[model samples]
Target chain A: MKKYTYTEKKDTRSGFGAGLHEAGKKNENVVALCADLVGSLKMEAFIKDFPERFTQVGIAEANMIGIAAGMTIGGKIPYTGTFANFSTGRVYDQIRQSVAYSNKNVKICASHAGLTLGEDGATHQILEDIGLMKMLPGMVVINPCDYNQTKAATIAIADYEGPVYLRFGRPTVPVFTDPDQKFEIGKAWMVNEGKDVTIIATGHLVWEAIEAGEQLAEMGIDAEIINIHTIKPLDEEAILKSVQKTGCVVTAEEHNKYGGLGESVARLLATTQPTPQEFVAVNDSFGESGTPNQLMEKYGLTDKDIVKAVQRVLERK
Target chain B: MKHTTEELEEIASQIRRDIVRMVHGCQSGHPGGSLGCADFFTALYFEVMHHSTDFTMDGKGEDLFFLSNGHISPVWYSTLARAGYFEASELATFRKLDSRLQGHPTTHEHLPGVRIASGSLGQGMSVAIGAALAKKLNNDKAIVFSLHGDGELQEGQNWEAAMFAPFNKVDNLICTVDFNGQQIDGPTEKVLSLDNLQAKFEAFGWHVIVSNGNSMEEIVKTLQYAVSLTGKGKPILNLMSTQMGYGVDFMMGSHKWHGVAPNDEQLKLALDQLKETLGDY
Candidate 1:
């Protein structure tokens, strides 16, 4: 088995902002629209260079989706930015009708996703966004692990046609992925390999999986860590191959246990391999204002949780 | 290609006939607004708009029109057909299974003339504003046009777009409001009075124009004037006055036929009044 180490930490949203600015320089058709969150979404550079292309749709997410859909009709690729809660849940019908069902070529760039959107609490944190977005017919759901990957994925989806839901988060985490890595949409990134158990994680949970792998190694439990970036087009081939070798799995994400990455992996395992699986996610409850560390600990979403989940699933195997 | 007064009336009469036939074929569509906007749609397709005979989804390097009040799709379909965007024979398939023309105009069916699906109200303005911005981005010079019902302005998103377009320098878009003063429930005044519509648009930083939408001469003249107002850094709006259910004798002056297809006897009478100018599809 192979291992990797992290030396720096950065928020995924900053990566998205950097990627968006790069996309502006690369593609002429790429235009951005934010619902009055220019500074928050880190779209300042894109706004600065191409001031005419950037639109400020004030506090109106639904109208922003509608306008983004319209912008695609005239051969302009539009990226809509806002908080995940308001971006998906608040404007589901608008996205459903105008973007997804119509099959418009629009990029829905969302920030502040999942429980790691610390201090804003449950009202702003959106745990069901992945489920909601993935359920749409033509929607591509991407949850990048760290800053570099987030920036890379943001730039990648600009060229890929059709409707896309790009989900990133607040709070800086491990920035282990390479700065210039070519981010593919549905391909899983394998960090390490082992025979005892497979850890499938997404978003902020990828680093947790890596930490849990190191912990499991001390106890002589060899664990494989795979970062599942694109959730909707779940890399079924990679997942099945890993689960076949390991015979058990642990899935982790900064979202609810019911509908997050864990549930997606469990669904795949149930029909295909029938492997024993455990989930490291926020239990069925809303989060309150707290530091990211406190919330992860309070909700049992730490590396210890992943380590325990791996052991529990191994017991089933 | 200027149409004389008599020719304009004939074109309007033909559009009215197509509207009846389309709604009757569907057995479920709004006919009153379609009838009311027949003259305006006829003028745009047959006389006013500079359109391509070969229909493309992206109307680049040419004028583009969007129906913000998409419930009036029958009128648009009839006009598009008369203008040769599609075969008139396809009119019989309106709202039928696997029809390209859905209950509302949708691009999902690969309909050549439609760019976006729009049955949802309050969304068209923003879409029009976006298309206008796209025109600016492309440096295409061609204008973007949109039509909305006066009552549909109740949707808050319309205001968001209204506040946005003018400030964003979306001057190439000309928005026309069908101030027919009627809605599904009743007269717009009785349902919800949108008093001073022209002033309301002006307050939102638009250059206001007024016209009798049902009159071909006024419609053509006002739209031509609207064309000249492009590239001025402010959106142009036309407060178009019309009569709900304009041509039909019995359906006129009320909101009874807004969403209802006429019965057999009523359909016969309505068809008889609207003479078949280019032959019914």
Candidate 2:
């Protein structure tokens, strides 16, 4: 297995803030809107630098979405920041009519996604956002893995035309991956290539998959790991190629098993080439208040969970 | 381009004819509010707004209009065609398959005049404010205008947008409500009373203007006055009052025709009531 290490740790939201600041500097037309929680979303730097272009929409997520859609009319790329729950389920109609159906160039940036939202519990933690956003026509759904990847995605989505839902998390995770990597919208990043088994992961689960890959290597089981950041436009070619080589797969994500990356991968395999697969995600149930680590462990989304899923899938194969 | 009050009235009569004809042609549409707001649409397109007949989605350097109450798309389609945004013959394809003229206003089919899709209520105010803010950002002197149904304010998103515009000081937006007091179910007052709308807007820090929407002269003058009130640090709201069905006498002031199409006899009677001054499509 390829050794991966990080010199530091950082929350993905800070990466989003850093990326937003950078995106604002690069494009004068890039504007940011927040429905309160500027601190939680880590958008203070962008707001401080580009005060004129920033709008503080004071807890009104629906209005924020509408305003962002409207801003796209006159050639402004508006990035709306809020919790993943508020960004999707709360203002779905607004996003549907004003942005997706209209095909507006608006980036719906959501932070604090999945179980990593921690003590805020199920109310703040949104596991079904990917499903909601992906169901919309012309909506680009992205869930970047770590700090560096999140920053790159934040800046990259600014240039991509049309509606995009960029999902990131609040928990501080290891800063793996290249700091200067070019973030592609629909391309999958091949983390480690092996032929024994395939491990597909997204968001916080990518790091866990890496850890699981290291463990699988020690047990004399070679695993191929792929980081699927873009959920909607799934990299079917990459998944099919890896799964054909491995003949078995383990899908991991910090989301519900029914609607997240696992289901997408399963559907792809079922349609193109049927492969034995195991899902390492929360079963169709809500999460409770706990530390990020505890929740991830209790809900079966840790590195150990991935290793177990990989073994289970290998048995099936 | 400018037109006299008489010319505007004549154009509005033609628009009313177009609205009834388009609804009758489709056999499915909202005609009551469309008929009610015909004069206001005519006034805005022909007299008040400084817009180009050659439309672009990014309406920079030109006054832009959004129909928030998109159920009344018949009026807007006629207004856009009359204003030369597209050919008048396209009006015949309203609500038909593969036509740009959708049941509600949409940019899905690349409609020339529409910048955003709006059929769901209470979303237009935020969109208008955002566009107005964009104009301010680009340093463009153009204004953004939008029309809404009075009953549509029942959605909570409207209040959110209402609070946001004033707080952000979005001064270049002029939004009008079709205060017809009628909706699909029944009268707004009986359904849900929007108590003292002027007071509500004033409290929200918007400059409120009340006008008779059915009269082209009053609507044009009121819109002009609303325009003059811009750039003074407050978003303007025009509460324009009108009957549900202003042109056809049988349908006037009733909510029954809100989303119903006129039959053959009813269409003839409506055409008889509204004079086709500029000729039908």
**Chain B, per-candidate TM-score:** 0.97, 0.98
lDDT of 2 by residue, B1-281 (tens): 37888888899899889999999998999889999998999888888899997878888999999888889999999999988989899999999999999999999998889999999989999899889989999999999999989999998999999998888889999999999998877988899998799999999999999999987778888999999999999999999999988989988999999999999999999998888898899
User: How many Å off is the CA of B224 in candidate 2?
Assistant: 0.8
- Candidate 1 off by > 4 Å: A270-273
Please list the residue runs of candidate 2 whose C-alpha ends up more than 4 Å from where it truly belongs after superposition. Answer: none
Docking class of 2: high
TM-scores of all models? 0.96, 0.99
TM-scores of chain A across candidates:
0.98, 0.99
Candidate RMSDs in Å, in order, are 1.8, 0.9
Instruction: Give lDDT tens digits, candidate 1, residues A1-317.
Output: 46667798889889989999999999999999999998889999999999988989899887898889888877999999999999999988788877887898999999999878889888998888888998898789999999999999999999898999999988898898999999899999998988899999999888888888989999999998899999979999999999899988989988888777778888887887788888888788888888888989998988999998988888899
For candidate 1, the TM-score is 0.96
lDDT of 1 by residue, B76-194 (tens): 88888888889888888988999998999888888778887788787888888888888888888888889999999988888988888887778999999998888888888888899
Please tell me which predicted candidate would have the highest DockQ against the true structure: 2
| Model 1 pairs whose backbones collide | none
User: How does each model score on lDDT?
Assistant: 0.88, 0.92
